[model samples]
Target: MTAGNRCRRNVLALTVPIVAVVVVVFGFALDRWVIDSGIEIAPEPAALFPSAPIMDPARQSDLDGAHFDALFAQGIAGLRAGKPGQAAAAFEAARRLGPKVPALYVNLGFARLALGQVDAAVESFETSINLRPAQANAYFGLAEAREQQGDMEAALGAMRTFVHLASEDDRFRRRALSAIWEWEAALGRRPSNGTDAAQTETNEYAQAKGSDLLTAELGRLDGGSGTLAHFRGKTLVLNVWATWCAPCRVELPSLQRLSEKLNPEQYAVVGLSTDEDPDFVREFLREVGVAYPNYLDPGRDVAFGILKIESYPQTLLIRPDGSIAQRIVGARAWDEPEMVANIESVR
Candidate 1:
């Protein structure tokens, strides 16, 4: 071919390919854009965060106080709905968005406490109180945690603060007073009689008097071959629980670890699950990574009465002869050195 013809042919070849490629790319882009436009974008993960500070349906559109108020209210609603884990997640997100709001931390603490993250709840409440000294709910939450840990004095102190700060909230005020009086009377009676003291310790009060657990023979689940009588002549850690109780869930793993570490010759750990639904209890155990042998309480309240358990997550340290050595209730950081010492002391 001549030079001009050759040049023209080469330009056509390059231009034609370039134009085809651009048209193809544009068509693909258009198709993607159309599809994306029809699809709704998913909500932000943290968009569900509580915003109670500035909450007013009429005013939520504004970035002002009403928006955050709505978030906070949403979190509170979550709590009322029995969705504590969701409430906590909401409160935590709200806290990040509005760092100065002490109420968010207090709410977060409540949610965490309900979820059995006791230490985290304590920390959140402490932070709330530090930020706003007048936040009475935080103090109440701290008191709850202290009570769970069996620290009557500290629990009382926290309750007193709650009463002092939230006198305006009549409900809280009445509750705090009742708790204080009950704890005081219980404390007075704890040290006087060993048996009564042991009973007191069955709930959270057992942390105070340092009492022992009484070994009571009880019926077995599924009509098992063994009986409470079989556990005789052995030191035992008997923990009462229910799948529905969050604190019970947290205490389960700790009890398991305690059991695995101790020699049966020296000590035994027994789990009594108070779930009326055996299947639910078994499923919960499997889901929660618990390996401890669990006995079902046919008449849940019967076991409670026999164990003198005043609360969920009640743990008893029993002597070889089936007498109580110590009783504790609620979720405690069992791995703590002090708790370890307490458990070891009974042996």
Candidate 2:
């Protein structure tokens, strides 16, 4: 070979490895960013009871007719208005009228917890459980109240019962299991065989059976309006988050990076903010530098009423055909190769 050609070939060989090394180092840094984002594994707040007024025929027969119904309606209204004190009073009156109804006591307990009456909340939950031993929601309320009171043992016990009594397909079952694992670790006890085994083998992404996406028009954080249908014909990583949730904040950067990396034609990462204040949500999105398409569900019509999502920072991977492909609870390293591969699998 000519001397000039040999010199050029050596230079090309040296430059290729240098460029490869830089690319490898950059990839490692990105992976570490995803891992070190402080994604928390703590359990989210349990969904409150009596999402609406409780007026079942069986329960109404036990009450003083319209009097109990009026009180129950008042309590539900109070809960919706964020007036837990008012809700507690109304529910207490309803409880007096229909002491035999377990749901009344459960709703009363939910309101009491909101008012920081932890001891009373425990009593109320226990009463509901006693009246109806299979009341899964009562156990969930008791677990949350006990945890708030710094009683990990009682919390763990209540949560375990909740997991056992709850349906296998119950959305809260997995969250409760995650809590059980955390509590066991906190108490320095080995996780029970069932829970530990499940945790170890748990896939980060759970295949969802049905479509839960809502087509309700939601206000965009930036401006104007949009509906979930706007993203039709694309694989969506729908992240349900709230501004106050620490884990949600921690994982947002990774989610933003993932949104940037994915092909916009095939995959879309969208955020649904459950925050009630649009201004606050807009400010938070700006602070976090999240550029993904996000919409606000201020009244939670979609998050709670339609989707029945009980926790914050929950992510749903939706297929192009609109079927829910996966339900991922808790914060995750979305930019990681494993997560990217999982998203790719569905696409």
Candidate 3:
């Protein structure tokens, strides 16, 4: 398949990024959004990154945003203090625990930018923009990243786009304008076609494309193997989660109930766990009394590698054509009336 034809997860919450000085003052980082530092980051794999012992999602997710807030706040503090490593770790943890928040990526991008991780910052900001277009912060960060890369044309495009899209009350509008003026002159010095490339990429949000699932391999709960193609012609509510995730566990019951409410002929609510311990996932599901059909992506070969998913408790609504209808990051009360209507709307 061609590059345009692939869509594993767009799972890329495809999340977004960042705090930046709109004036493009390369050395002097200023603004309320620029983070301060202090938290120490661990060098372990993302799944094993260390944190204070979690209080259990039972006491967490149901409350909606406490654990996430604390962690995100920690990341902000770390960034404010200029500790990008610490901030990156905290934000990475937040993406796992919190909703796949776009701004979180922006903050992450800001830290990366400060750390001079220009390429990574671009990816972070682009991911944020993918998750949410028309976001001033992500565009601002993108412009900053482009400028740092010496792509003056791209930088001007992003900044001008930012100026155009920013809301009237946006705090960064003044700074964006200042950056645009500076970049335009810089672009005048040497003309380049970088803007079109940047805009082309910007137009394609991760969610804007359809995903192909016919080739996706999955392991069934009962020692069976299958492909997502098996469920063609029905709307698939595919939930990507992990047993280690508090929010995933907290959201399971509702998902199970939602599955019960769905029509077999028209809809299917499926669980895809990214747990390495399949036995543990099976036992956990059984203990939780969840009856929805579940599958595994042991070692996250499919979840992280193919899908490029970064957050847990993310759900994607796949149309009969296998195109993703909606991608919701974070946990939600799946059986709520509003939720039922939302799912039904996809019908």
Candidate 4:
């Protein structure tokens, strides 16, 4: 999907408005339309300031598009009415329905920004980028979040990417360029390895795929037999976990939610538990209402021996053709937009 961006102005363009918005999602109303995606940005070294303005390049393609959802509209309405809390909730509810629009996360970021939730705003913007890396406006919001965290290099790099990807005719292109220039002057370079932020983002979570293994028979929690071969035609989200691992327990519900959100015909999320006690696993699943098919490996042969998995709560993304695509070694918000889209994007 082609991503779109919308921002009434840049962060440093107006000191009063930008600061107000970041502190509180901006004004109760800015002129006529809602400053739907405003953030508090400070240009000075003392604070995280907005550099310049970058307007929305694809206004029509946002939540108001042809495939509109009521929740998405409600979120926009909340933003427009100066009620960011309501706006944030609406956006998340809309996310559960799995709307693929990148702007959705953009608006959610603004709402979080207004609430003074800098970390969450950063997550939303990054997720938007994950959905569509070319979405120029997401960079605008991200620059602010990175600045707030005192990551000047990352912030500068995000603006640079925005400028590179944004169309020349984009009304706010000049303003964004101005921000970049100011950031570079202040930092004394084009972001001393700022691009590494994006690189490390992927590097931390993404692992290289390897060859398919044993395809061996395994014990199902229901007493029937199973194997990786049964899911050959679908992308398998193989989560290696155990009932005893606390992080695994924390990650399972969201993984189950991820399983539910994905198209069952094309994707399957299965649990590979290494618990010696099948009844304990059964009790854990039943207690959590986890209905996904799970296979047991008491001896750890299939896990440690075959997959070479050395950690608990590990996840592997298996392609439909029986090859591994990606692996994650820790807990994650499996149901988040980035993770869901990552799963669906598997070839």
RMSD values for the candidates in order, in angstroms, are 18.4, 27.5, 24.2, 24.2
| 81-130 per-residue lDDT for model 1 (tens digits) | 98998898778767756776677898998999999998898899989888
**Total backbone collisions, model 3:** 18
How displaced is residue 82 in candidate 3, in Å? Answer: 23
lDDT for position 91 in model 1: 81
On a 0 to 100 scale, what is the lDDT of residue 191 in model 1? 46
Which digits, one per residue and each the tens of the lDDT, describe model 4 over residues 1-347?
A: 22322233443467787577676644445533565556656565664345866565663323343234688889999999999999999998887665566778998998998888999999999999987665677898898788788898898888767665543345665676666667766777544655534334333322321234426557787766667786888999999998768899999999889888989999999999987556768988989989888898754656764577889889988888877789899999999998898888998
Task: Candidate 2: give its CA RMSD in angstroms.
Answer: 27.5
| lDDT comparing candidate 4 with the true structure | 0.76
Q: Give the poorly placed runs of model 3, Cα more than 4 Å off.
A: 1-211
- lDDT per residue, candidate 3, 249-324, as tens digits? 9999999999988888999998999764457788999999988888887545456544557888889888888877
Q: How many residue pairs clash in each candidate?
A: 30, 0, 18, 14
Error (Å) of candidate 4 at residue 179 is 72
Q: Which candidate, 1 or 2, has the higher lDDT?
A: 2
Instruction: Tell me which of candidates 3 and 4 scores higher on TM-score.
Output: 3
Give all candidates' CA lDDT scores. 0.71, 0.82, 0.76, 0.76
Please state the error at residue 8 of candidate 2 in Å: 99
Number of the top lDDT candidate: 2
Task: Using TM-score, give the best candidate's number.
Answer: 2
